[model samples]
Target: MIVPSSLFASGTESWRGDGRTDEFDSVATASRALADGGVTAVTGAFGFDPSGTAALIAPERFARGTRSGASRPLPAVVSSALTPSDVHTDRIRRVLAAIDEGVVDKAVLARTLEMTFDGPLDPADVFARFLPGPDAATTTAFAVPLDPAPGRADHWLIGASPELLIAKTGRTVTCHPFAGTTPRGVDAESDRRAVAALRASDKDLREHAFVVEQIVDVLAPLCRELDVPDRPQIESTPAVWHLATPIRGVLTDESITALDLAALTSPTPAVCGTPRAAAARLIDEVEGSRDFYAGAVGWCDAAGDGRWMVSIRCLELDAAGTGVTTWAGGGIVAGSDPAAEVAETEAKFRTVLGALGVDPADLTDRSRPAPAPTST
Candidate 1:
């Protein structure tokens, strides 16, 4: 057997990355292959917009230092840290109030609220909430700066991402599009319809388009040669049908890193919205605080072939390890319903509910979904 450590021979070797953006349809197979191939980890690089580093990370103590994407004899890494921004509670409240007042009909609002644990935070405890069985499908990963440094957070997270971002040798760069989100439906047919509707919906297409364009746009400046699909293809998973696109290019300068490219593609339209700047501004003003929820938090090699998940499916652990603080959001198009948006938020938070070690019945609380309008 090729020992895992022996599989990679690129130690300090020059890299020419070849990347392809796959979708959920390819995730399982691809991940399996990576595992079978003795890849330390197979990651979904764009996870930062939702779960922060919780997907591609394996539970283990990694050797320290930033390994380049093309490094050899190391665990497969996912991303570099994208820290949370200052909380904007006032902005979130304004939008919700606007929605409630009917000044605006629909808007996709998000929050990055922070919660502190008096003691050390253990993500394993946080993960306990979501994975029903010990063997439940879940992954949590982070890069803690070595030593007791009092600077940036030593730890990060990306709870559970369904997407993957990739880059490889040969100067190729790519992203795997994964969307068409739906909850675990009451029945197979219900889930099927959710997937089907998302696939057919124009709004969903618009959302996918936003991400594709941004990926292309983001990678454009960094690449010497580029190739983007004219249209996205349908890719299905157990729970969703993502709009997948293939983006490939050669790096303009090797000095620049894949992490840099991943950084640019983060908060893509899958989690954010079209007209990204406008959407983020609106969200910043409307969604309150995002904390680390939507930030890109993953580890990558020195060459940048790691995965980063959006920190969506996660919860913040309390020091006592008894409870967790969590948040969720939805894509609010002009046609969205207040009640439906509320329901979607509720659905979006399911994974967190599980991570907090709370039963679905346990989350019933007085916090109702507040409205957000376009009046800002």
Candidate 2:
């Protein structure tokens, strides 16, 4: 697990062995484990669907350190996307229709790309490639081992995420949600223009407001005092620029753990959509199971202090270690352009594809018209 301030690596045995069973109350289970005094911290990942299974663990041993820049070259690989670009864009159009119909104000849609390596890929090495500098206060890189399906090899979820789902410390609660996005420009001048354009775009601003408003509504009842900026600021990563709003609150009930806050506020408009249930239903009909793609990952201590980062800019490695599936998504609103949305997901994919020595440009051909939508 990794946060901007620290990196933690854990091994040995989990307090209750593999904790990835079908639908259980993970937050409640962790609370009980912490209350029992068997472990100081509970770490792992929560799936995208709140009711879905989670891969949580109470580690027996763990080490903490600062972030590192170490990395190794990835081997040769073949890549394919699970969802075709045309199909994904067509889905975006469908979401636009939903927004027009007032089904939801906004929704996040994602696509996945799978890569198979020529040899076994080392999780540690791939993770190393994902780590950011210690000064990268806006980024979090993580590598969490997941429970394998019966008869399958060990699997892992790994990525460098730029959005914080939630963090808690003492009576303090914080969430930094990222919404509207634009690809980084090719030159310094173009980049500056891109930032300026993003800050002023009405469409982007509307998209961002949906995320901030939803988060504030969820957190308001739980906190005695909450601070939300009047406007979002530009948050830059190597691949894209995002409009981010940092929200902080003082909890009225210190008993509320980070996991609880996460459960309440996650799948925010940044990852899900406004009127979450309506958007989620639309997503399920189109994208099927998200697995853990847009889920949250982190550790919460017995003191109810911990951090969770949105599971974007991430990939899942199969048991054999050769197959990898990474996902990227964008929020869709009434003004969203289908072509631009497709490009946005592409820009998001660059965070991982570039690291793996893959040229993202070669992955999609835009000259041809996107094909009509079909069942997956």
Candidate 1 residue 208 C-alpha distance from true site, Å: 1.3
Worst 10 residues of 1 by lDDT: 2-11
Compared with the true structure, what per-residue lDDT tens digits does model 1 show for residues 207-308?
A: 566677777777788888888877777654333345677677888776444445555676776666656656666665565434455554343443435544
lDDT of 2 by residue, 138-181 (tens): 78777777662222236778888888989999999999999999
List lDDT for all candidates, in order.
0.45, 0.77
The C-alpha local distance difference test score for the whole of candidate 1 amounts to 0.45
Candidate 2 ranges beyond 4 A from true positions = 1-25, 66-71, 148-153, 361-376
Give the number of the best model, judged by lDDT. Answer: 2
